[model samples]
Structures are given as structure tokens and as C-alpha cells.
Target: MRAAAATTFTVPAELSAAEPPEVRGVPRDGVRLLVARGHGPLRHTTFRNLPSALRRGDLVVVNTSDTEPAAVDGHRPDAPAADAPPVTLHVSGPAPDELFVVELRTPDGRRVLDGRAGESIRLPGGVVATLMAGHPDPRVSTGSRLWRARIAVAGGLRAWLAEVGRPIRYSYLRGDWPLDAYRTVFATPGPEFASAEMPSAARPFTPEVLAGLRRRGVGVAELVLHTGVSSLEAGEVPLPERYRVPTATADLVNATRAAGGRVVAVGTTVTRALETVADPGGLVRPGAGWTHLVLGPDRPARVVDGLVTGWHEPTASHLLLLEAVAGTALVGRAYAAAVDRGYLWHEFGDSCLLLPIRTVHRAE
Candidate 1:
């Protein structure tokens, strides 16, 4: 099958969801859900109906990675003595030698910061981040715009971040939101903060939704994939991120498959973690490590039979993964239907389910 990695689409700015449905006076689970089956008619439903949409034997795997406050406001120590533009630092992930893979954005979140190597930037709460080098990935094409820097904080990194950092937000958002808004309902409370951004597919789920799934005999499993900064720019490839699939979850997935159940991933993060440790026979194994896996038309899914995710941006690289799960033709139809129905797009928006169908034809 031909991969659609290079394919592009247009998303109108008006269709972007500037605020969460809850902020608009709707419940968390009141968002829309677009159900797209391979070669089947597209179905429009609500997120609360998820429990009734799947079979009893289906296993839903979710990412339990907690969101970290990765964004912080900073200023260059050596700028013009008059007026220096403030910078926004987005901590992508950890790098070798206590360094961090960071993206330098302007205060408006429109362009990257113009800084040179060896420059010192003063951040909030007395933290100083120094640019150690340019693009860390040698495999990246020449003139890449990413930055690699090291930070010096008085206390521990996590503790200091908790005090000064805010959740990384894009320009589309209406205003600043608290860190709690970026976390999923199933997020585990612990010292370890994993994702640089939210694993948003499960954001629409609430306690009521989980209870419904449990009562319907649908199994839910958990995995952790600390995601890095999202590559929202057009044609940008995502960087590697840490992931872990525990033995319990792997066993559940394998057992469910053996019992003629579908393995449904709640988000792209879960799908990436499971596929990384999946054997040729499609059996998942317990594993933990960093993965640079990128799913597209060229990469066919072997472990995940279905995917529950949110509507992605037109230029988002994640669209390639959706195309891999559902064919190109089907994905096209699904997006058309979503836009036609005025479904919201983004982390706090609606959801979509791509499942298998008996027929292999495009929806009309």
C-alpha cells in the first residue's frame, strides 16, 4: 500500500477549538466522537457512547503518562541594552549530559527564538538555561531549527519546574489553562512526570465513561509513553520519546487477542509503545526504552487492531499514523465528515475511532 506521509490537507482556522467543551459549559464527556470503520459507513456519536460501541471482548489500551509543565518564560541575558524580546522555552525532553532538547519560541508562539550557541538565558525562578549546541540530531537535514540546551536550577529540576513552569500551549488556545486541564482522567499521581504534552485522546473520558466501559465488560489496560514536544509544523518528523509497557498490560493484550478480542489503543502514544514491543506474531512483551518509531502509509500496523484518538490538525504528522490504521481513502472521508459536521479539533476537542470493518470499500 502507498503511504501518505507526504500528503497535505487544509484546515480552516475557524474550525479550531479555542477552548475546551467544559469551558463552554459542557461536561468533559459531552464532546463529539466520529466513528470510522475501515470500509464501513462513517458514524457520528458522542464520547459517552464509547462503551456501547465496542464489543465485550475488546481490550482498550491507554497511555498513563502524566503531563509535565514544560513551558517557561525566559529572557536572554545579553540582549540589546534597550528592549529585548522575551522567549518561551519548551522543554522537549531530556538529553545526554544533563542537557535538554528544547524548542525556543517567541512570546507570541509564532516563531522560533533567534539565539546563538553558548548564549545564556535567564528563566523564571532563578533558573538559567545555556545553549549548549545547535540541532542535536545529526540525522536531521541541514539548517534544522531545533535547539539543545542545559539548565541550572537551585533545587531539583522537577521541584523547580513545579514552581515556575506552565503547560506548553499553542496560539490557538483562547487563554492560559492550568496544568490540571492538560492531564487525563486516568493520569497517575506520582513523582515521575512523563509527557512534554498531553496524551489527548483520553481527555474526553470521564469517571462515568470509565464506569460504563467496566460495566460493559470492556477491558482497559495502561501503558506509559513520555511524549516529547509535538511536531506541529508542516512536514516535521517527531523525535524519539521514552515508553514502557508493563508485563501486566502486555499479558492482557495477548490474552485478549487470543480470545478473539480486538486490541484498541486509546492514543498514538499507546499504539507506539505497544508496537515497539510487539513480536512478529503480534504478541506484546514487557519492555521499557526510547523509541523513534514513526507510523505512516509505509508502516502497516501489526499489533493495534483499532485506535481511539482525537481529530488532528491538517498538517499534523500524526495523520500519517491514522492513515496507516485506516486506509487513505477512508481517512479522507472521515475528515470530510468531521469538517462537514463542525466537529472541533485539538487536544481539548472531539474524538475519533478507527476500527476494522468486514467490507474493504470506501464510504460514500
Candidate 2:
């Protein structure tokens, strides 16, 4: 299905957060939180009070996929001049037969790197990636910028990435940040690094916050969803990404719902993963596979009752998912409040919680 271009809004330049709160001399949980019910005036709070905002017996599902240093500098060996502009490879995810889905970005992250199919680009740390074809998904727009490429690294992809790749950064960020800063407190260390970008919604969570949630009887569970490169241009649907919803998470979610408890998704990644596996009866099944599921207002959610996420760009497809959860009117009110209150924007910015007024009353 084709989605119309999202409407735009003006975010003040000063509202763009250049660094994480820690780098800005604030504790992780000290970040601000904007709470919005399904229909009401938005309220402001601190991230540390997340537990108080959640109901007892509620299940908070999170994406434990760790961010990978997907951005690597590369050059075209076949270029005519030595002064050829350098290219950047933003690794999206693994493809079949040792190939990868990647987006070619300019060095400054402004535009796509133009190249023909069958051309080989030399990447740093002795890696070579050959552009094999355009994105395999037929539903993707003809103007979609992703490509399927075969990667050849001397010691393999992970080792090469460790030596040369950096976390994918957009034009808004000031400079490179350490891998530690990109990781969430609950990120799991696995053999394969999955996400092209950090699931930034959980970045404000800390051990203290987790303890508070536990003490408040709010159950937390994790699922894995290897997210693709975001920051898409206008009107672009996200490509398919891999996900694994374990039996434990599925059972917990179903149990919570059966007990008349809320199932809160910590990020859009979690919402996508859960909704992909949820049936109309609101039962989630154990599954492991790739999903191209896109959430919007037309698609009513089955399992997710609330969402905890960071502030998104005005035109982001994620805003559509937020609309699905909280409705368009509430989302508009919450966003207006957030912008007027000078809440920061981007990955390191403040967060918003979207729930129904009835659910908030139950939690309280």
C-alpha cells in the first residue's frame, strides 16, 4: 500500500539535541518525559517516574537488538580520478548467500552514492562490496535508495566492522560518538550485531529505572528485532527487517492481556515486532523470521496497548504508528505540547508515553 508523504512541522534549531544527556551533564534517567493519554491534555514528568506511570501487572516489551557499526567509509576503485569523492556504506541487514542490504550514502550523509549495478566499491579494513541489484522488495518505491550487495571481508564482516565501521549518524548529529553511547542499558551482546541504528527509545532506561519498574510489579520482557537503516527520505516505506519473538515473551504478553493488563511497547521496533506476530485475538505466537509489516492508523493494533518512545521527526513513518496507538488528535496535542515546552528532539532527546485515559487511571 502506498502511504502519502507525512505532513511537516518546524522544529527549532536549538531544540535539536546534539549529544546524549550524559554528555550534556545530566543523569540518564533525568531526561524529561511527556505523558499523553488517548484523549486529554498532555502532562510532563521525568523519565525516572516511568514506573509510576505504568500499571501493576503491565508488561513492558523491549527490543534487545544491539546496534552495529554499520557505517563504513568506501571508495570506487573504477573511478577515473584520484580526487573522487568517498562513499559510505550503511549496512541495513544480512541478505542470502553472504550478501547484505545496504544504502550508499555520501561522505557527509546528504545524498545517495550513485553507482551502477555490478560495480565494486572498496571499503575500509580490506572489505569489498559489489552492488548486485536494487532492493529486492517489489513494493518498495522505484525511487527507493537501497541496494542488495555482496560483501567480501578478509576476516569476515564483524571483524572488519570492528576495525573500521562507525555507528550510522545522520546530518543532524554533530560528530562521531562512541559505540557505548549508542547502546541501551538493556542491549544484549550477541554473536551477530543486528540493528543499523540504536533503538533509541530505551536509551533513557537505567538500572535504577528497571528496579523501580520491578518494584512496582511492572513486568519487563525482551524480543529481538534487527532494525534497518532509518532516516528515510520522504514517502519511503521501510524495508523488511529480521525479528525473533521467543516463546517466553509471547506467553508473557498473552498472559498479561488475559489478566486484563496492558502490554506496552518500548519502541517502534518492539511495536512492529509484536504486531507482526499478533493475531486478531491479540495472541502472540512464537516466531522467528523477516517481516515487512508497516503500522499506520488504518491498521488497528491487536497486542500493544501503549507506547514509550522518543520524539520522532515530523515526517517520520513512525509518527503513523504513533497515530495508530494514540489517535491523530492526541498525537497532535502531545507533539504541540512537546515542541512548545522545548523538549529536545532526535535519539538523545526526551521521551513520550502514549496510553488511554482508562489505562492511566488503572495504573494510577
Candidate 3:
């Protein structure tokens, strides 16, 4: 089957939901999933079967970036003298050194603002958010415009979040979902103030499933990437969220490659982590830093050889990263199969495991 080109896939608004899935804590590896080869047809499966899908010595890279309850609502300090209407501040992104950038949505429009460095944005009921920095992301209008910003947080951000911030629920499932629904089963450490929801590599991996994969010879590695809240706004412009790949994670990837193992990224985040640090010939080195690198068809991958991820919306920028690995033909084929099979879309939907075109051919 031929895959569709990057230009051929577009995000459709109808597919996104205003609510999240009704299911919660359904064993990370118990989620429904699909597997496809190149642009070929899809095969239905459970997430627990993921390890069986790969060969021994294939390195599976997972993003351990935890989801953050970064959404906050408040009134603008620069509010007009007239009646001060409340504004919604989504602490969508973070800057270097734990500073925060926030999206301020008000009657005027959505604007990106920075909280006073080390100062907090006081919300209704004593909830205070420390301002980090103010670097505005590109904007899109939806009756009111939407702006993405980063923010720094402290003083029980996670505990207080249970009381104030709502799980940055996608427009799906029609109602609010519990926080556990937005996280992976193996989630450790408190949530970061960056990701709106989990990066989800751990989505399909239960403790048992991970053990099985290890038994089968698949080596797994983890990395932390504090992703910003997902801006699923229709027609939203794509922007890079600042992230860091720790030296330890880099070492594992390098060791795997040195041993001639296939490095399989668990999600786009892992792909970003590997690609961000990789040089030519797919050589990986230890490093920590921010990456604005965007991948697509024209750009070849230096580190990642495969990606395991959920179906993306038509407007999602993730389509570009998919193209970089499997090419337009393979991704298009897999996506079409996903649609025809009635596989769910978005974070709660089924997933696909994509291998490089070369690997598929070699297997053939």
C-alpha cells in the first residue's frame, strides 16, 4: 500500500472532542491498539501485544515526561478600568530555569504574557502561579484568539492543581475526565507544569507488558521531556516547546546504537529527543538542551528508526514527524486504514507502531 504525502493529511475539526474518554486507569498496556507495516493495512491488537510486535535487541525509547495540570483562570493585571472580566490563563509552556509562559484569554483576545519572574499570578481563591518568562508563540483566532505561553510554578503546583486546574481535556468524549485518565500507568514524580497531558509512550506499557518485552529481548530506555500543554485549537500555528534530554537518556540511546540494536521511539517526544541530540550517521552523544528542530519528509532522521504513537488529528503538526520516518506513502496508508477500521483518534484512540521503510523491506 502506498502512504499519503504530508500535504495529503489535514486535521479535521469534527474529529476533536470537547471532552475526554470515559475510561480511566485502564492499565496502560490494556488500551486498544493497531499495528501497520509501512503503508499497508492495519491489524487490530491490544497494547499488551506491543512487545511481541518487535524483535529482540530492538531498543524501545519512551518519553517519561509527565503531564502537568498547567491550566489556570484569573483576571488580567492589565485589565481595563471598566468592569474587570475574568480571564483564563493556560500555563502552556516553560522557559529555561523553570520560568513560565502563559496564554491569557480575555474578552479582548488571547495574548501571551509572562508572570513577574519569581512572582506568582494570583487566581481566584488564593491560588498563585509564579510567572517565568514571556515569549509569545504564534497565534490563531477562534472568535477569540488563542495564545501559548510558558510559566514557572511552585508551592504545591500538583496538589493545588487538583483543586484548580482541569485536566487539559481535549475536545472529545463530551465531559471532564479524571486526572488519572490523562496520565500513564507507570507515571512517577509529580506532574510537570509543561505538558497539558501525558506524552503517552507509557500508554501501552503496563508493568507486565514491559517485563514481557524485556523477556523477548527488547531493550527499553526512558527520557524526560516537560512538554507544554497541547494547543489543539483548530488552525493553531505550530510552535516548538522547549525541552531537555538528560545525559543519562542520551547514554542509553548511544549504547543501544553501538550494539547495533534498532532504536524504536515510543512517541514523537522521544523522536524529538533523539533527533535533537543526534549528529550525522546517527551518532548519539550525551547532552542537555532545548530543541526547535521540526522533522518531515525532506529531513532524514539521525537517531530514531521507528515511532509508536496514536492517530493524530488532520491539523496536527505531528504529521510532519511521521512523514520523516515512514514517508508520506506509509503514513497515509496506515492512517487511511485506521479511519476505515473505526479506530479511535486523538490521545484516547488506538495507536500505530511504524518502522522505517528500510526495516519493512528488510523484513519482507
Record all residue pairs in model 1 with backbone atoms less than 3 Å apart, i.e. clashing.
3-297
Per-residue lDDT of model 2, residues 1-364, tens digit only: 3475243467898998888788898888999999988765677999999999887999999999998988998887665647656888898889876689888888877756456677778876556898887776524533447877899776778778878889998877887899989999878878885898999999999999999999999999999998888867666776678999999999999888878889999999999999999986678999989888888756867789899999888778888887777677777777888888999999989999998543322211
Name the regions of candidate 1 deviating beyond 4 angstroms: 1-8, 78-82, 138-144, 358-364
What stretches of model 2 exceed 4 Å from their correct place? 5-8, 78-81, 137-144, 357-364
User: Model 3: per-residue lDDT, tens digit, 1-364?
Assistant: 1222363544445544233333544555666677766544567788889888888878887876666765566664545525445666666655545444455554233444433343334575665554433344323222222332333235555566657776554434566566676777555564445475678655656689888888999987776666765554544434565566667777777777676667888888878878878886676766565667767655667778788998887766777778787777777878877766666667766678887545321210
Ranking by lDDT: 2, 1, 3
Task: Determine which window of 10 residues in candidate 1 has minimal summed lDDT.
Answer: 355-364
Better of 1 and 3 by lDDT: 1
Q: Rate the local accuracy (lDDT) of all candidates.
A: 0.81, 0.83, 0.64
Off by over 4 Å in 3: 1-27, 39-41, 76-86, 96-99, 105-122, 126-134, 137-163, 190-194, 232-238, 246-248, 359-364
| lDDT score, candidate 1, position 109 | 83
Global Cα RMSD, each model:
4.0, 3.1, 5.8
